[model samples]
Structure formats: structure tokens, C-alpha cells
Target: MNDKQVMVKMVFDRWYALLKNCDTLLNSLTDEQLLREIAPGKNRGIYLLGHLIAVHDDMLPILGLGDKQHAELFEMFLKSPDSKSTEGIPSVGELRSHWSKQNVMLKEKFDGLTADDWFGKHNSVSAEDFIKEPHRNKLNIILTRTTHLAYHHGQLMLIKQ
Candidate 1:
């Protein structure tokens, strides 16, 4: 494989692996377990899952994939941290479905991109700005989001115990 192919593969592999690990841990937990905070005053497992879904959903637009499918989730998950108010949050089942759908959709969109496409600027950057900062490409988004996934995944582990 060429350099671009090799680089994309490496990042993609890490992303998929981290996602799978997160999914396994998430699936193993009950809704009650997820509702508890990873630590007092910190985010809960359910909140983290919803936050991840919203963040990944937003990546669709940022990566030039498509419009977000779960923008409504940003209110409870992204715009705010965990709280006593569980007002309009979706059920754990719904959140799980959303998470699954997001990953499948993302994988399909990501698979469509060629190595050259991976090197192209994501929607977040201007053409001129991208030229000045070539490192901020589609692959970099996956890399950064993967790290984000790993961070939350680690937090989710606290619930598993």
C-alpha cells in the first residue's frame, strides 16, 4: 500500500478496535448501571454513551459525509454535562440503537473514501486554511475522534466494574 493507504488503514484500525471494545463494554452493562456516575459529580455511563453518539453524529457534517441524524441529542449530551435532570434523554435501548446506526453509517461513508479522499480537507476547514495546515484532513478527524472514543471508553469501564 501507498503512504496514504497505510496511514488511513492504521487510523481506521485503531478506530474500529476502540469502537468494538466500547461496544462490548456497553452491551455488558445494564441501564441501571449506566445511569450511575463513573465518579461522583462526573459524567455517567449513559451520558457518556449519548455524548459519544452526538459527537459521532456531528462528525458526519464535519467529515463531509452528510447531515447529522441525531442533532437533537446535542442538547442533553453535548451542550451540557450530566445532571439531575434526565428530562428528555432517550432510553438506553434507543441510545444503543442510535450508537449502532451511527457506527454503521460512518463505516459505510468511510469505506467510500479513497486514500486521496482521506487526504482531502474535511468540511470544517477552508481551502486556503487547509493548504496552510495540511494535517487537518479526514484521516486526522478519525484519529482525533478515535482518541475521544477511547477516552470515553475508559470511563465506561468504570461502570463495568
Candidate 2:
């Protein structure tokens, strides 16, 4: 395989591992535990799952994959006096199913892109500012995004205390 393909494969493997870890961690939480806030101002397991899904949903489009827009998913996690309760937090089973679907969609989207397509420049806004940057390649974007998710996952693990 070419270097680009090899790189994509590596990113894909890491993404798969992240998903597996999330599934395992989530599976260990009881419904009551998932809904219980570990501490004041801290997100519950359900909220974390929603946030994770939101991150992937928001970023996938930037990688050139047109999928469902779930921006509101993240908004629900934000602290607001008017914010709704975690009652809407899907069950671990439901989150797993959704995660699996998204995983498949991600793999298909990544697999369909050509090496040139992966490296093509697209106008992408940075998270901190509106400045545009060329998203080097889907593999690069995926790697960065995976790191972000993994970081959050680590935070989620700390909630077990």
C-alpha cells in the first residue's frame, strides 16, 4: 500500500480502538449510575456519551462526509439554568448502537476517499477562531479528532471516582 493508505489504516486502527474502549467503559455503567452526576458541575456518563457523539457528528462533515447534523446534541450538555435534565440520555445499549452506526459511516467515508481527495484543501474553520486552514488530509483530521476524543474519554474515566 502507498504511504497515504498506510497512514489512513493506522488512524483507522486507532479510531477503532477508541470506540472499543468507549464501548467497554460505557457497558460497565449501570443506568442509575450513568444518570448520576459524579460531582457538582461534572457531566454524567450519559452526558459524556452525548458529548462524544456530538463531537463526531460535528467534525465528520468537515472531513467531507455529509451526515446527520446533531449540533443540538452538544448544546444539551452545556450548563444552563434552562438546560433539561439527563432524562434524555440514551441507554448504554442505545449509545452503543449509535456509536457502531457512526463507526461504520466513518470507515466507509474514509475508505471512499482517494489519496488526492484526502490531501485536497478545504475551507475549514478552527474551533477557537474563524480562521480557515487547509485540512491537510482526512487521515490527519481523523488522527487529530481521535486524539481529542481520547482525551475526553480519559476525563470521562475520572468520573468513576
TM-score of each predicted structure versus truth = 0.97, 0.75
For candidate 2, the lDDT comes to 0.67
lDDT of 2 at 95: 67
Off by over 4 Å in 1: none
Question: What is candidate 1's lDDT per residue for 1-161, written digit by digit as tens?
Answer: 99989988998989999989988998899989988889888888889989999999989999888899998998889998687456778988899999998889899999999999999999999999999999989889988998999988888998778
- The most accurate candidate by lDDT is 1
Best by TM-score: 1
Clashes of 1: 0
Per-residue C-alpha lDDT of model 2 across residues 1-161, encoded as one tens digit per residue: 89876766777788889888977877776766666665677766676677677778766677767855565565664443213374655565676577668767767877788876766553364543332444554556677778988987786676666
What are the per-model C-alpha RMSD values against the true structure? 0.9, 4.1
